[model samples]
Target: MKKDENLKKVAIAAPQLHRHKVKLKIGNWKKHFDFNYVNTIIALALNDFDDKIFFYINGYLITSNNLYLVVQTTEKSAEEMVTKIENQIINLLKTNPQKLKENRSEVSIIADDENLFYAARKPLFKIYPLENDHLIKLITGQKVTLPYFDRDLEHLKNRIRNHPFCSAINYLGGIGPVKVTLFKDQIDPEI
Candidate 1:
């Protein structure tokens, strides 16, 4: 798949510019679902939402890594953005060809600026309720500061590339060693 020149720039600017982030857990990683298909639908919906908003696979989590769509909003509140995004995704899924089930999603705020996915910060272990189920156990079981590891961005990109859906769509910037996909509002949008 050919890379869109405009989107390339958005990918680079995503981490630093998009401060207000909302992590979306569309489906369960433990259970089987057409990831590419679902993500494509979600991506299309996001593309229709806003151009500056960015989307990516939360591959940092060691478990239950779900699709994360982060929107950079200057006017709208985070709660409002999350609700709109969820609603947009739901509306799109209504016409899905395969009757995609499991709409139970966890949408929350990434309050940490040191987060790898949200910020240009080093890819480290930042626990979220949806992805890391054993976070509480990790906190209680260990005495140290959760043993956070400094993950290489390249390594994370490689891991994402290995996924079967890496080459699924151009919008999925994870395709072939990329990080995130920015659906520019000015582009040939979808929903």
Candidate 2:
């Protein structure tokens, strides 16, 4: 086999996870997201890729009929990745005999970025392991406004900074996540 001139392997320092905002909508407003099925599909899909696909999984939300996930992963064509995961979810829902009565999910990819910041009550971060050693503590601010919060208009950004990346995101609803700077050593210099 000939060596590929375009490819160069880099060691891991910190995983520069891009934020992918995905909303999985059940056709019927009365139905809930098939949690087990969603997990199963994503797990199965990730199994096929040896590269680290996810970095920080901020968490997910279940509105009346939709499941919203805020995921951070290495930037390897995030839209394509989400589409692949969604297709797998659709197949899983269609194949399950028990789920035949339900309609398939409408998975939508909202945004992809490495600089997205998210804030919630200090008491409610139960699902994501924010303290994981692999995750670098970028910023921690208080009182930022997000629809995800109980109130409106008056929100605080914990340790927030203004970065061009903050404005480039097209799908964070109206609420913005805090922006943090990465150290020179964090990103691969050659990349």
Candidate 3:
């Protein structure tokens, strides 16, 4: 596990700027990444347990083959968080056996507390969709947005639409990345 070494390198280069995220590598289940089913199941479970979830960064690959979730809390460790996530996923499978088949996974703590993998890049340039039109600024000067990928909304509308319960997000500034949760309704129908 070179995770500690990688974090050390990142720390020396970008002190105090980091993201606490988990990279879930699931094998043999890429076909289950469907929005109508798989993605929705994950979203609903996370939404149901919202207090523990910090951000829904994205799917690791364009093929929707991996899950990139950002979460931070002093109450739990990386292993604990992964255990909870795995438990949620197992619960999902137990409740809906037809959603997906058997699978294997490897979860790791990929970065600093607030710095997601995206902002971890040397020069960040990806546009994150805010849950709503409302944008925010951290104590440092940076923009943060929680991209809302709604199903029924138009491409443009979906970009602006947020979850019914939450609409607030912070901009990605020198502080790295902030927590942007996925609302139960944020699943993309077209995904």
Q: Once all C-alphas are superposed, what RMSD does model 1 give against the true structure?
A: 16.6
Task: Output the number of the lDDT-best candidate.
Answer: 1
Model 3 lDDT per residue over 107-128, tens place: 3332232322222222111223
Candidate 2 per-residue C-alpha lDDT over 1-191 given as tens digits, one digit per residue, 9 for 90 to 100: 55786678888687666655454453331232355443443444333443444544343333333433445567555455456555544444344422321247554321331111111111111122223211122221112333555322211122113321231121233233322222323442111
Candidate 1 lDDT, tens digit per residue, 1-191? 55675465534443533233334444332232354555565555555554544433222212234543333354345455555555665555444434222444633332331231222111212323333323211211211132555355334444534544332223443343323333433222111
Residue 180 lDDT in candidate 1:
34
Query: Cα miss at 131, model 1 (Å)?
Result: 12
Among the numbered candidates, top TM-score falls to 1
Worst 10 residues of 3 by lDDT: 132-141
lDDT of 1: 0.37
